[model samples]
Target: MDAMEQVGARKVTFIDVLRALPKLAPDGLRMARGAVGLVTLKPTNKESIGHIFQRAAAKHPERPFLRFEDTEMSYGQANALVNQYASVYAAHGVGPGKTIAVMAGNRPETLLAALAGVKLGAAVGMINTNQRGDVLDHSVRLLDATVLVAGRDYREALNEVDTPTVLDLDTLADGATSDADPEVCATLPASTTAFYIFTSGTTGLPKASAMSHFRWLKSMSGIGGLGVRLRADDTLYCCLPLYHNNALTVSLSSVLSAGATLAIGRSFSASRFWDDVVRTRSTAFCYIGELCRYLLNQPPRPIEREHQVRVVVGNGLRPEIWAEFTERFGIDRIAEFYGASECNLAFINALNIDRTAGTCPLPFAVVEYDADTGKPLRHGDRLRKVKAGAVGLLLTKVTNRAPFDGYTDADASERKLVRGAFKADDCWFDTGDLVRMQGFKHVAFVDRLGDTFRWKGENVATTEVEGAIAEHPDVEQAVVYGVSVPGTDGKAGMAAVKLRDGTRFDGTVMGAHLANRLPSYAVPLFVRVINEVEQTSTFKSRKVDLRDEGYAAGVTDPMFVFTGGKYVTWYPDYPAEVAGGKIRA
Candidate 1:
């Protein structure tokens, strides 16, 4: 019945992008010819990300904007809805500079609300709904959130949240009108904060990173618009939680700025993912490595090779699974990228490398990292740069072009930043990730510095080991960590597993699974079977305590080990190959 809905019903054409792009980038001369197709970006000093939408809406107002199951909205309808939400926020005492926390599952409404918040010059605090206990309390408090906007289903779950005010989305949607004609006081400026994304802290408490409108807009223009080559016809499939930067900043913001359609799933469902892709006729989708592996585990289906998807973009697509995933799913491009919610540097796999985080278009350095201590090696003032091909600490220079405003918690923010990092006069942000520079600004991800350890003279990647352990059909969740062994130089890799409901797990099957994928030292020496896997607010497994528990069987519950070909509880003294010295402490 609306103008946008009518447009959604029509077939999308490539010509639409050509027409809309000129408006999106007004100075057509500014963009080099064929840059869009060649996957190269043109440099420009843009004022605001809102300019992207303003240009897009003017050019393609009627193109499909969002799709949720059978429901859909065109660009025009979405613009109007965003405006209406902006008006509502202004009416409710939420204006420029204020922080509004959004707690919900992935949905079209979540993004709509975020845009509305942005329009009001209010920063959207992406709160992980799964957070409980102290983490939940810390996230809300850190953002200095005045209002908590959440979905109806989560109202009870968030009842414990002691924020000043809470607004249920279901109630707001039912009672409020999508009327945003009035001028909103929250017109965002370049310096305006757009997002307050929380990052897991090495010091226990999470830190809230401030994302400015200028940086956000630039990301859309430089990365999403130019790098990903998003178009009006593209329907971005997002199944990750809205709380994450991967889903919020990368996927939704990029597509919305390009005036493309967005198809939001409730959550990542491996069984229904490909089916949903076909049903939505999505041209592109976002993924994390774990989500991709989950989908790959599903019985290979004919429909996978028959989908309309041409490109899939996101961070965390592992190198080992890269070729198989893309080829099997018929995806032409996998824009595998590297970034953190709180760090300055970003690496886009623009070259489409199989196992690398690709190239850093920004200024960065790889410095020497201590494999034993898992810390960056520093001398009097300067940090040592690693050899060209060795795994080292990743650092990005803080400059005007790439400013690091850091987090709301000043102390936590200051901790990771090092003054005069590369030189006595320069400053940079320590990424905490260890990467092996492959030259040409490209870096191959080795592992998370602290999470990785040397076992039997070989460095073990916890993610790689966990991936292998997860393949067992009986395993529901597997968390791998390195535990210290007496008299050894480094740690021994151990696995904490949770079995699938009602399934009896066999250790031999798990051992075979690991033996097939990992090296002898990389295989988890100790397996602790439990009923549940403890995860962080964003579903990342918490490994500090697990590592502290070490291989002491009775220290944990339901511990199991491989003996003769079957799994049996080790109790106190587990079967040990202690004599071979295969594990280092």
Candidate 2:
């Protein structure tokens, strides 16, 4: 079987290392220097994100740096713009110890406004452009922004919020200011705050996580220079919102680190993905797993396989489609990496491993967890490490080297800490993710802790069940969540599936396929056929509302129940009957 098709497979060999070593040798020293800087970085290191950009500009002044639609700018031109914006911001009292909240779509000015703030040693609050109403108001207030920079299109949205100061992007970019680099860029320390990226508020209100200049610099060396391994000549197509870390830190930093060109996409369009890539002549691109899945779902086109894209980099590629995506798209490499916006640790596929999140040197462990309580399991007083090839909670040790620069909310940050796990006085950052150990420091991501539910004394992974359902020809998308079952020990498995147009639900085929794919306890007991599944701006399925609704009958969507080896239409009396133990699950 192919390595990716197998569960918990560890197939990396000495020869594999030999082959990968040569590939990494070209940038090995650069990565090593970055690693050393991460360890030795101090508050007095007289380095900022702006300083790094200035360094890249000095070295490759004439190199292509930013491209959006018809406009393209060299490193020299970008630095000049950054300097001009910084000077304007400085005149408006923007300096160290202040924050500039940037809320706009994925455009050149959105990024330029942020770079300007960072240039003057001010932290840039990366507010989600998709946010509105209370959530958008909270993000700006939480950051305590000194100035709010937004696109003119967001004028109505801005009217709803009470901001300290507002600068419209369309109007702000026209002002004439000095194009000389700020001296503060040289004096600002590595510890200076750079960006305040808000977390995706899937549960409640989102919290702003601080991204320091040092952390951004580390990403340049670690995820940027090392993981993606972009060449100076490479042009990376990035469409993900600049507010998110994937685009802001991973995509942008990676491009800047390599002194390469970044072709900006206004937004992600499944129909226009290949057209945009071809138009930009991009040699690489950034992606999330869902983005890749959407591309796979699109009708096959010749331009898809006929692009200059040699390697694509990002995280969250499900294993079920790993092999298929590569073969269908003719992608030579998928530089999959695993990291969070606030987490101190990172796993990058630096060696080009198949079906793994790659390697990390920082201290971490996969330990047995108690799903009922939603926490790690402790044997007596110490948490026990699960055997290799088993799914368990991922804990990253918090140390001086791998420091947890947590959220702006100190109380929220305190809750994620797991102290005294293996040893007394030791603290670890709870990743809240379950992963399978693949041995040799490589790991396969299983599912998020919140998404895993206990059923019949076994943990059911939603992603696994959803992947199986999506394999069916009639199914367009599947979202698996835990739903309450009367008299059941734990929440029963439930799935909200969208069928392809002109296709109706086939319970027998779906039940049979799921039976062959997942264990009995893992298969969803209830399947709800809906017209659409709601998703976040980043394409992640929004399950809280669906999970809240449960197996109840809806106005538009029909519900089904699995009984006697097949799914059948659920009636109103089924809930009472199941509660009365007439029909046992």
Candidate 3:
């Protein structure tokens, strides 16, 4: 029996899980009692995602909405700040259809300004701070920003770039607000652009993916309400970057929609993570995989297991670590979800399943995935479907209700669309992720398709390879990717690892470990030892730069390459392999 069969039977299986969902009456009243009560059932009737602020203001105006350092803002005050910023934005000719760019870290004031911009029809283009040089220049340029608002610290980077209408957020925050009509504050339509969130650009340069108010509202209603079950008294721990959808749309909006409290942080601190949770009395938190690993690495403290945290929701938490994390941290719920900022549909952990990406109550497909190239195979007009309980490429149909609001660059946007999927003339958005259909509506996330490669006619999933490598005692973190060899069709695998402090890497031990678990081709041919891995704002490994500098000794930090069944210092002697000719590029 295969791994799927090794797993015991559950309550549901494959496509039947979709049909097995508890049916609601045609009138939809029954849904409100069970589903609605579980998740927030309210859909915003008021225009814009900021209707959340309106409702929160009305319901809990005196309640603390934002906490930053020693400063705090009530829901009423936050709404006022948003309105004030909207007025300032309108003064600067920013309204509906315009793009306002913001470059900063996570702060309540930054969020206030962003909410203010979105209150009007203007969209906020969230730029990552780590981005520099051409990529940084390209992001603001792509937004075609009417106004650029950034903190004082980023002025140097802003000076380096040429953009129209630059406003320092420090200057904006200095002025006091006068009474303003709450109703006069600009209202956004459902279809209006709310934010121009950039893609992570692991493959290439980041492109702006326009997020609509419609998508934002639906996410808050469907996933946030049903999956997370956020409550008004609950304080959300948002240490993730405001630029990330997980923090912005998922955490902040979800809280405001529920009249909940928000505990903002400048950035994630693994040491201070639990302290901050307890400090804020946070009921839930948002997380990425690395953050979880970092928390797990901390020496067990007495307070580590104690917190008000009942639920933790986010993406990229590995299935291997799922049970260990929840158990160690005393978390009651893990609402793992799978979706991309550039994609439309999302599969949320609705049933509170342990390791799976919950379920998709919408139309989706799990098609046969090509192991070598990692692309889905096309069968006539339709992509081949995966058998029950098999791993495949996850694709969501772009129906009327689940429209794909693609990126700003048309060519880049077109790359994610799978034409004629399921049926001729039908369209599906490629999630670019490998997922296992876990017997029911639940799906277990596998590795990313693009990161998987092949050697000797066998597929090697980078996540699997990395997970195996990470098991070594000396290894702290492992990032695996594929690199071209001079004379090979399939790319050879490579891994860069950060060793545990004060521990030296044992290449022999790593080699033997890999040999025991993975097929020969699945084993990494090259390894690079590093002080730390470079990650995006959301904790995803930045592989583009690493892939470019493949095994180049001095190009990156201290490095090592696997060879001769053991690891050795990477040197310039391997010219044939570096040229990509070995991989027959």
Q: Which candidate's TM-score is highest? A: 2
Stretches off by above 4 angstroms in model 2 are 1-19, 22-43, 174-176, 201-203, 451-585
lDDT of each: 0.67, 0.79, 0.72
Clash tally for model 2: 0
C-alpha RMSD of each candidate structure in angstroms: 13.1, 11.5, 11.6
Q: At residue 135, what lDDT does model 3 achieve? A: 53
Spell out the clash pairs found in candidate 2.
Answer: none
lDDT of 2 by residue, 270-368 (tens): 789999998988999998765776677677999998898988988877676788889998888888887878888788888887778887877999999
lDDT of 3 by residue, 1-585 (tens): 767645432234544544434431231442243344324322233457666576668677799998876677898888877777777777788877888999977788789889887777678999876565455787888999889999877888778778778887867744445425345333545767789887643344566888887778777766676667676688888898898889888887567656788889788777788888888788999977656766776678878877999888888776656778899989987878877777787778755656677777778888897765556797765588887678788898886677888988888778788887766688888887777887666787665668645443334557767777888888899998887654333457888889999998787788777766554556787887777798888888887778778865446566665666666666665535433222111
* Candidate 3 ranges with C-alpha deviation above 4 Å: 5-46, 173-187, 451-585
Ranking by lDDT: 2, 3, 1
Alpha-carbon deviation at 531 in model 2, angstroms: 23
Encode model 1's per-residue lDDT on 226-323: one tens digit a residue: 44666667888887778777777788666865678888888777778988888988999988765676666668888888788877778656555677
Worst 10 residues of 3 by lDDT: 576-585
Best by lDDT: 2
